[model samples]
Target: MIISCYNEEHTILQVIDEVSAVLPQAHIAVFDNNSTDSSKSLVLGRIQMLANSANIDGGGGTYQSFIESSAPESKNKVPKTQDFAAKINVESKRAESKRLDSASLDSPANDTTLFNATSITPTSINPASIIPTSINSVSTIMPNGGRLSLFSTTTQGKGAVIADAFALLDADIYVMIDGDTQYDTAFLPQALAHFCQNQLDMLNIARATINDSVHRKGHSFGNKLLSTAAAIFFGKNFGDMLSGYRIFSRAFVKSFPAQSKGFEIETELSVFALQQNLRVDEIEAPYKSRPEGSFSKLHTFRDGFRILFMIFQLLFTERPLLVFGFLSVLSFAVSLIIGVDIFMEFLETSRVARFPTLFVCVGLGVIGVVLGVAGMLAHLVVKGSKEARRMAYLNHKKIL
Candidate 1:
C-alpha cells in the first residue's frame, strides 16, 4: 500500500490500522513527501520510507532549486519497460567476471538489480511537518524521478503524483483515497474480500449514503450534482461518483494511461473503464465528512471544470457521433420552429414572413447535418481504439 497524502498526521494511524487488520500479509509502505505534521508517526506497523520531498533552505539568502525531474523516455533513449525494477539492472555474466559471484557456488546474487529507491518520485510533504514517529529502523527513501508539476494551478497536492506512486509500485491491486478521514475504514475488508471473491478487474466503493449530520453541506451537495450529471451523460450511474476510495486490479492500473493531473483523476479513472469497456463493479460503503480541524483541499471551480473536461474527453474518446448527433437534433429543431413560423405567415395572406426564417433554417439544417456526419466518423475511430485496448489488456494479464 502506497499512500500519497499530506497533513494526514491525526488519522493516518487509524487508516493504517484498518488496512493492516485485514491485509496482514501485505507489505504496506508509506512514502513520505516530507510532512510538517505528526503524520509520519501515525504509520502504525508499516515499513516507512522517506523520499526526497524538498523544502526551501534559509529564507532570504539561499533559494535555489531542489527537485529531480523526469518524463517517460523515448524508445531509442530507453525501450519501454513494463518491469519497474529493470531500469537499473546489470547482466549476471559481467558480475561473474567481477568475482562478485559467490565463490561457494551460490546462485547468481543480486548485484546491480538492487532497488535503487532514487527513481521513485517523492510525495511532497514538508519534513518539518511530521511529528516523527518513534522508530528504530526505517528504509531511507531516496526519490528517483519527477518533481511536483508546477504548470497546473492546482491546490490539490499530488493527486496524480500519488496515483503514479501506486502505478510504480507495480502491484496486483491499487487503492486510493484522500488524506483527510472522510471514508469508513471498517468496510475495507468487505471491499478487498469482494474483489478477491469475484476476481474482478476493478472495484469502486460507492460512498453514496451517509448519516446527514456526518456529511458537510458544500462538498456533499457538489458531489451529488456532478454525480448526477455524470450518470445522465454516460447512461450509467454509481451511487457515488466522486468516491475517493477504490480498489483496482493490477491489469487495470498497468493499462490505464492517466491524463488528468489533479482531483479529476478520480473521474478519469471511472470514465476510462466505462469508455474502455472494462468490467468495472461497485460496492456500497459508509461516507463521512471530515472534521473542522482539517479543511478540504479541493478547489471547487477548478476541479469541477476539470471533471467536466474529462467527461467531454471521454465522450469524444468513446462515441463522437452520439454526442454530436444530440447537438444536431437540437439544431434541426430550431430550423423546424422557423419553418412553422413562416408557414403561419403565408397562410394569413399568401405572403412570406418579414424575417429570413427560411434561409436561417436551411443554414442551420445544413450545418447540423455536417456536424452529425463528423460525429459518426469520430465514433467509429473511438470504438476501434477501445476494442484494441481491451484485447491488449487481456493479452497482458493472460485472461484470454
Candidate 2:
C-alpha cells in the first residue's frame, strides 16, 4: 500500500504503473490524503483502467467456465416436446439463449465477477446497471481477480495514513513506500526475498546511494545524526532511520501501536520492532529524486526535532533506567562540583562562608539519589510490561 499526500500529481500514475508492472501479483492500494491538485483524479483514472483490464482477463475465465460446466448438462438433450410445434419452440429457445450469451459478452455483467471463478451459474451473471461517471461512484468499484483500492481522506500525517492502512488491509506482507517516485520498484523482489528466506519481522529499505542532487545536505546529515542516536539508545544498527520504504509482516503490522501522527512514523516503526525484540533487517536500496516539478513535503528541521523527540521518548519509555540513570549521573556530577568548591574554601580558610552552596549541593545530591531509585523501580515496571507485550505478540499467528 502506498500512502500519498499533497502534490504528487505528476508522478503518481507512473509510480502506480511501475509497481504494478514489477509486482504483477501484488495488490496495489492508493490512499489519497486530501491532495489539492488533480492527483486524486489522475490516480483514480489509472487505477480504474487497471481494474478494467484485470476484470476483462478474469471475467473471460469465469465466462468460459460457465460455458464448459453448463455444456455437459446441455450435451445430452432429452426433448420433452412430442410434435413439430415443440421442435420449432426448441429452435426459438436456442436463438434466445444465443442472443443472451452475446449480450452477456458486451454487458458489464463480467464487471461484478470478483475473481476467475471456476464454478458460477450462467443465470446469475448481471450487467452493471450504472456505469461510473465520476470518482464519487468509484467506492462501489471492484476489480476482478485482483485487488486495487483507491481511498480519499481529509486528514494529514504519513503515520496516521499508514496506521489506517494496516487496519484496513489483510496481507501476508504489508509494504509501504512514499507516493513520490523516490524509491524504485525494481528492488522489490530482492527486498521481499530477505523476509521469505530468513527469520525477519521487518525489512527497511535504506537509501544507501543518493542518485539525485535534489536531496538536501541537511536532510542527509540529520538522518545520520538521528540514526546514531537511535543506535545508541535502541541498540539496533539502522542505516536509514528515516527511509519511508519498508515491509512488515502481518503480525508486526497488526500488533504495532502506531502513535505517531507525522513524518516520525519511520522512527516509531523501527523503535517498536526493537522494543519487541523482533527480528529486523535492512536492505541498501538506491534512492532517486522525484521527477521534475515534483517536490518533497518534509520540513527537515521541524521533522528532525520530532524524530529526535521520539527517540528520547522511546528511550525513556522502553529503557527508562538508561535515560533516568544518565540524568542521575549528571545531577550527581553537578552536586560533586558544588561540594568540591565548598571543600576547597574550607580547606583554604578557617570556616565555610557559602551556606547557599552547601544547601544547593545537598539538594542536588538528594535529587540524584531519588532519580536513581525511581529509575530502578521504573525498570522493573517496564520489564513486566515488555513481557506481557512479547507474549501478546507471540500469541498472534505468524503470517506466511
The per-residue C-alpha lDDT of model 1 at residue 83 equals 23
Estimate the lDDT of model 2: 0.65
User: How many clashes show up per model?
Assistant: 19, 0
Tens-digit lDDT track of model 2 for 1-400: 4545567898887887677666643446677877889988886666545444434544332211111111112222321222100111112232223110000111122322321111111223222222211121122122222234565555688878787677555555777887888898888878877876885788999886665485798998999999999988888979898999988776787688788888998999998898888989988888887788898889999999999998888888889999889999999999999899898889999688999999999999999999999999999999998887777678764645
List per-candidate RMSD values in Å. Answer: 12.6, 12.5
* RMSD score of candidate 1 (Å): 12.6
| Residues 1-400 of candidate 1: C-alpha lDDT, one tens digit per residue | 5555566676666665565555542334454445567665554222221221212112221111111113332222321122211122222332222110000101122322222222121122122221111112132212221111111112344555555454445445556655566777678667877877887776888875567876557666777887777777775677677777888766777677777666777787777777666677898887776766666657777777777787788777666887899889988988888788788878988987566677898889998898899888888887787777777677656231
TM-score, cand. 2: 0.75
Worst 10 residues of 1 by lDDT: 98-107
Which segments of candidate 1 are over 4 A away from where they belong?
Answer: 29-159, 208-210, 288-292, 299-302, 340-356, 398-400
Local distance difference test, each candidate: 0.54, 0.65
TM-score of each: 0.65, 0.75
